[model samples]
Target chain A: MDKRREVAVLSELDKKLINLLQHGLPVCERPFAQVAEQVDSTEDEVIAHLVDLKERKVLSRFGPMFDAVYLGGAFTLAALAVPEEDFAKVTEQVNSFEQIAHNYRRTHYYNMWFVIGTESVEEIEQVVQGIEEKTGLEVLNVPKLKEFFVGLYLPV
Target chain B: MSENNNIALTSLEREYIIATQKGLPLVAKPYHAVAEQLNISVEQVLSMTKDLQERGIIRRVAAVPNHYKLGYQYNGMTVWDISDEHAEKFGQMVGNLPFVSHCYLRPRFLPKWNYNLFAMVHGKTPEEMHQLRSQIKELLKDVLVERNDDSSQNIPTQSNDMLTSTEILKKTGLRLKDKTA
Candidate 1:
């Protein structure tokens, strides 16, 4: 079961802060202060809210979102179709690799989907080959040929 | 942007990423905390962060709220078998939709996989997701490949489909291995 289905109740101020902060916070001596000003709250209050949100697992991360490729690394969205009997073992093998950043079970013929983030472009291929050998399954290596849009802004 | 060159993180920048990749300290002066930890001045941290952003390395310094916690429980990876000729044109149209969070063009694995355009859509419920999917379908109606029901070709029978994640097996922030270690 999806454990995150339980929704967290948000106050009006929390929603306002989240909507504003998702776009970004300024880079300065007091970034939270700037956010507080825009959200019509005190710096301490803003920080408190953020701390609460993080503790509650509402905000997964609060920091700079780095581009893997730009940082001399490579990442690709790959998928695999594992036999039901071997699903558990294959998952352990795939997740054991530190390069596998995220793995999910989706409803499809190609059930297991994971993202491989490596230190270099060449390393992406190496990891893919490793996964294929480990699981004995064809890994669909699909790196983005072109990105039309990439942004996550969900208004609470 | 296709050409992967002219972008390399400096040693200090790498250290900065390693230090803060998980997250910044939840403090009034988060940068100050980072600067103190790295044994650098606040000005240096600020400047380095700004430089990274300017170089397109750091997409943004922001808060990433979990959509599930925000009432967006239904999320789908909506993929389409778009014609290569009109993929770019139709991709842009679908991406421009306010509900679409991410849209991209990816290579198709001929016999096994046929989706070329991928768009991620999130909604509070299944009905909402279906509606949003319909909107995208209507926008790409002209370019979407007709359903290939031919079983002989070994291709996907549908023109488009949505993959709803059933379980999150593993999830973690991208970690950059430390070379000095």
Candidate 2:
């Protein structure tokens, strides 16, 4: 946390770039230039700021956000309650599977939660079953029945 | 259109998605770079991307900030056990909240799990999140109270729990099949 406080402060230009980019980058040949025009910066400067931001670890990713479901794949949020002593062991076993996309240890009974992404809908179960067999823990598979909102944009 | 619609994607669109999934190059002409890779014109790449956005295949082409680094360290996965009859409408209302990044109605595993409505809230601290949670509780109070009054069998009308992430055990980007053969 202390390290984050000292990395770099966002300048007005950086702030404008983040604010504009969060909404989206134009889908054109010179998208950065388009963005620069909107942000009062040159194409070269916008690209430089973005590169600097990425290098500083401010932006995790910069690109088109693809819908996994639309790409003919299946995804789900699953959880497992692992014992304190076996947490490390369980993590190793669970992460061994490539299908596990994002795993988080939360403060709850069902502590170990992860998003599983598979090539097809049927494979979702197969991957969950494999994890159970390997980890010896019951997986509480909770797929989203309905999604109300998803996009997140924080102004800088 | 619904996200689950059976919209057939052309091969070119598939190629574009696979190529740009990792991201576009941070250059003066990012789409031009993508076009060169796919052996297509820059205009074609741009139009295809626009088409994908219109079709809801691509949510947006944007910069995803590292929330933790951006001072939004406290994130709670708030789950609620709202009645099935009103979950849809209630979920929509909850989703419209500014702090709620993701709102969903998911299946509940009985006996162990009873939560169906999940809304993920992002904040700088637990106190900030507590404030947001109270807002949600306030919004759902009337509905819950009405549910309890309506039926004696379904005693606990609505209940919620917040799960804060302690550690990121594993994280990987969703990868697509390579079709540049």
The candidates' DockQ values read 0.69, 0.58
TM-score of 1: 0.91
Candidate 1 residue pairs in clash (backbone atoms < 3 Å): none
* Best prediction by DockQ: 1
Residues A1-156 of candidate 2 have per-residue lDDT tens digits of 445433347889988988788888877777887888888889899899999998887887899998777776778999998999999999999999998999999988888999998877678889999999999999999888788988787665
| Model 2 CA deviation exceeding 4 Å by range | A1-8, B1-7, B145-158, B179-181
Could you tell me how far off, in angstroms, the CA of residue A138 lies in candidate 2 after the best superposition?
1.0
lDDT of 1 by residue, B1-181 (tens): 4423436567788889888888898898999888987899999999999988897788899999998889988779999999999999999888888888889899987767889999999899899889989999988888888755768874456889999887888998777676778
Q: Candidate 2: interface RMSD in Å?
A: 2.8
- For residue A41, model 2's alpha carbon misses the true position, in angstroms, by 2.3
**Candidate 2 colliding pairs:** none
Question: How far does residue B144 in candidate 2 sit from its true spot (Å)?
Answer: 3.8
Give lDDT: candidate 1, residue B4.
35
Displacement of the residue A153 alpha carbon in candidate 2, Å: 1.8
Docking class for model 1 is medium
